[model samples]
Target: MDARFLGITELTEVPSVAVVIDVMRAYTVAAWAFGRGAEKIVLAESLDEVRALKAVHPDWVALKDGPPAEGFDAVNSPGLLRSADLGGRTVVQKTTAGTVGALAVKDASLVLCAGFVVAEATARVLRRRECDAVTFVVTGEDGRAEEDLACAQYIARRAAGEEVDAADHLRRAMESRAASELTEGVREGAHPDDVALCVELDRFPFAMVAAPDDSLMVLRPYAVPR
Candidate 1:
């Protein structure tokens, strides 16, 4: 199926496979960690619980979700991942929107984590699988952001086997006239670092999928690490 973009509230009504984007930090960092050789990423709804998991797996790496204002690691900065030496560790991640979407879409036929950094890879995966119906669940700022829309459209077009005209998508996706306008939203409470990270067309080959349990699900594309 062709991939489409849906707002979080619209997710419950959509029947297509969901590719959730918490790009500002959640999915972006998850993608970065996986790309950097992290074995897996455990997405948690609660920061305290993430820390608890870290306590048990002390050797595993951990990062908390702190937005730009809070001065915490609420969103994993791309620069941080790019500069760190992750090697083969597993990263335990918690975010306001990314993990929350993971928990919310626990029942989707196939729940995949995506971001601009991994958009091309994600599109390739979807096309290879030939999913009958696909949708992008964009976890926006309080559930709103143009970055999510742009990424989703990029994937959606790819899934449809349509040629991607970056310029066209940017013109339509942004609120203002130019691609530069999209970045302006970042200053209005959106994470500027995240905004920058999400705009990176394609930077990773790894994908993050939900590993379902009962109440919550974790975002890790590969097998869960011990």
Candidate 2:
């Protein structure tokens, strides 16, 4: 199997399987949500879609830019979700990087969302599936966030049957500009705890897979083979 790592902007060619990595927040939060019993997470490319989904399904938690809407449960912060009661609830997530990158791969045979939390599980699944070709989409904030790039490289290395030192990757990611912003509270709506959680590699034993369910793209957890 051949694996290629590319940033979100270089997604001109879609592979048989695409793993979208967003370690700074997005996919890390999604993994936490799933671990906390979230029924499913719908990936929205735009804030407008998130609002529309919330309007139709008032019970769903919507995460958009800036503060969360009135009566909404939370924003796009993994730290906030840590205390949330997402039991049997659906979450609608719209982020600038992760979800956008996931939506861009229109031709991928399978779409998987990844972060440090689900890195091992994602790699195991990819190896199990044995796809002829796989692409790692590092959905960095703007151009190429260091955290996302590190997480993507970790997964790529694991999928290629290499021993990965997750701690080293996490250390590098924690020192990145994106991590600095989140930790120092420079980025609005970002929490330091979110960055802490994002860098905890292999926190979960399942990978989030974006599968088509009717008209929506639902993120469901796939348990990694032991």
Candidate 3:
């Protein structure tokens, strides 16, 4: 199996398997949500779609670009999801990169959303499946963010049976602008705890797989050995 790393811009070139990385917060939050027993997470490409979905399914939790709306369970923050009771509930998520990147790879034979939490499981799955080609989509803000790139690299190396230093990757991500926004409280609706949560590599022992449910893509957690 061969693995290739690319940013969200190169989502057109479909591979046998695709993994979308968003270490800053999106996939990190998703891991926490699944850890808390979330049934399924719906990935919405736009905030408008999130709202429309919420209108029909009021019980669904919605997390959009900015701060979460009033009465919503939580924002797109991993720390916030830590305290949420999402058991048996569906979450509607719309992010700048993660969800958008996941939706863009419709042609991929298999699609998975991941972060530091599920890096090992993702790598294990790829090797077990023996995919001919795998694409690691680093879903960053404008183009490629340090945190996402580092996560993608880590997964790629692990999938290729290489030794990865998790601490070094975390150190590099902490120095990134994306990490600084959460640490320095620069980005609106961002919490310092969220940054800390996102950097905890291999925190979860499950990988999120994307499956078609009617007209939407639902991310469902599949447990893997730690």
Candidate 4:
């Protein structure tokens, strides 16, 4: 498959498969939710929608951050999600970067949300797809989120048949201001170990694939071998 690297601004033109990346936490949370055996996750467009979905379907596990509302299950933190009992539950996720990136994608047959924790596995999933082009949507537009860009490039390189290790990319992510915010408690509700958790490259053996289902962008963990 031909690999295309683009920022969120260029999401207007997508092809074949698009991998939306948010390494600071959103996709990392998706990875941990799957690792916790979550049945599926529904992406919400706004915090209001996140609350509405939970209010209507109280059984759904809602996750959001930045504001840390009263009703959500937890903030968008990978450290918290790592130990969450999400098995057999539907996760309603709203985020600043990852969810927005995934929702912006148009005309792509497959959409996969990714982070460093699931980067290599995502690449493997992309490699197995019968498509002419694969686009990596770098969801980190904020000055602090260089990590998202790093992880996106890493996944794209791996998908394009290059032999690469994730260590270099991980280091770059650690140095980003997003990581600093997590460590310094600048990002509200961020877990203490959030940075460390997000940088654990290839921590999951599955990829988070998002698809449209009943008006919700449903995400499920698709198993992929390392």
TM-score of each candidate?
A: 0.78, 0.94, 0.94, 0.93
What CA RMSD would you report for each candidate?
4.9, 1.5, 1.5, 1.8
Ranking by TM-score: 3, 2, 4, 1
lDDT of 4 at 145: 62
- Which candidate do you rate higher for lDDT, 1 or 4? 4
The TM-score that candidate 4 achieves is: 0.93
lDDT of 2 by residue, 1-226 (tens): 6877787788776677999988878898898898888989998867778888889999998865446567456777788778888899999988878888888774578999999999988989888887678888877865478888888888888987898778878887999998888878777776658778888878999989997777778888888777
- What does candidate 1's lDDT look like per residue over 1-226, in tens digits? 6555666676656354788876565677787777777766777767677767767888767676544433233245664565566677777777667777776777777788887777777777777777878877877754456666777778778767788877654444344222343356432223345445555667666567776655447666643221
lDDT of 3 by residue, 1-226 (tens): 5777787786556777889888888899899989988899999978888888899999998886557676455788887678888889999998888898888885678998999888999888877877778888887864468888888888888888898788888877878889888887776677668888888888988889997789998899987654
Give the per-residue lDDT of model 4 (tens digit) for 129-165: 7556877788776423689878888888888779997
How does each model score on lDDT? 0.65, 0.82, 0.83, 0.83
Question: On a 0 to 100 scale, what is the lDDT of residue 222 in model 2?
Answer: 89
Clashing pairs in 3: none
